[model samples]
Target: MIKTSTQNELIQYVYDELAKNASEQLETAFMHDEELAESCSELLQIQNLLDNALKSPHKRAVQNILNYSKSLSLQS
Candidate 1:
């Protein structure tokens, strides 16, 4: 099993937040640890999926919200 600290470091590495020295150390570990490397690869794929996901609500949803607000304000 991977240590919690190592798992945290993997997350930091995936997010580009790990320090250079630590990042280098992790890379070295990857050379000898296929599971670690696979974990990193999976994290990268998840990050890419999240990055490409739609950011905004659909226009119809927004319009419905606005209309609801307008009706409430008019009733006030």
Candidate 2:
């Protein structure tokens, strides 16, 4: 199994959130490791699919969450 940190790094890398240095590091790793390259490829495909499927939360859902937060704040 891949380390959690590596998986998180791959996710951030796909989203262009990784640091330049880390990105370069991962790039070098991917070049040397076929598995890492494949993992990155799969993560990128999933990221694209998610980007295409993006949508705003429903108004009611947002309102419900806000209301829940207010209730929790009152309890605190």
Candidate 3:
């Protein structure tokens, strides 16, 4: 099993948040450890998915906000 700290490092590495030295060390570990390398690959895939995921509010949510604003304005 991977250590918790190493798992955290994997996340940081995936996000490009790891320090240069630490990143190099992790890469070195990756060459010898297939599990660690696979974990990193999975994280990269998830990060890519999140980066491309829909970011806007739902249409219903926007309409609800607009309706609430109109109601408040009518009371004022």
Local distance difference test, per candidate? 0.96, 0.92, 0.96
Q: List the residue pairs that clash in candidate 3.
A: none
Among all candidates shown, the one with the greatest TM-score: 1
| Root-mean-square deviation per candidate | 4.7, 6.4, 4.4
- Candidates in order, TM-scores: namely 0.71, 0.64, 0.70
lDDT per residue (tens digit) for residues 1-76 in model 3: 9999999999999889999999999999999999999999999998889889968989999999999999999999
Q: Candidate 1: misplaced stretches above 4 Å?
A: 56-76
User: What is the per-residue lDDT of model 2 for residues 4-75, given as tens digits with 9 covering 90 to 100?
Assistant: 999899999998999999999999999888888999999888888988998898899999999999999999
Q: What residue runs in model 2 are displaced by over 4 Å at the alpha carbon?
A: 54-76
TM-score of 1: 0.71
Order the candidates by TM-score, highest first.
1, 3, 2
- Relative to the unseen true structure, what is the C-alpha lDDT of residue 42 in candidate 1, on a scale of 0 to 100? 96
Candidate number that wins on lDDT, 2 or 3: 3
lDDT against true structure, model 1: 0.96
Poorest stretch of ten by lDDT in candidate 3: 46-55
Give the range of the ten consecutive residues with the poorest summed lDDT in model 1. 49-58
lDDT of 1 by residue, 1-76 (tens): 8899999999999999999999999999999999999999999999999999959989999999999999999999
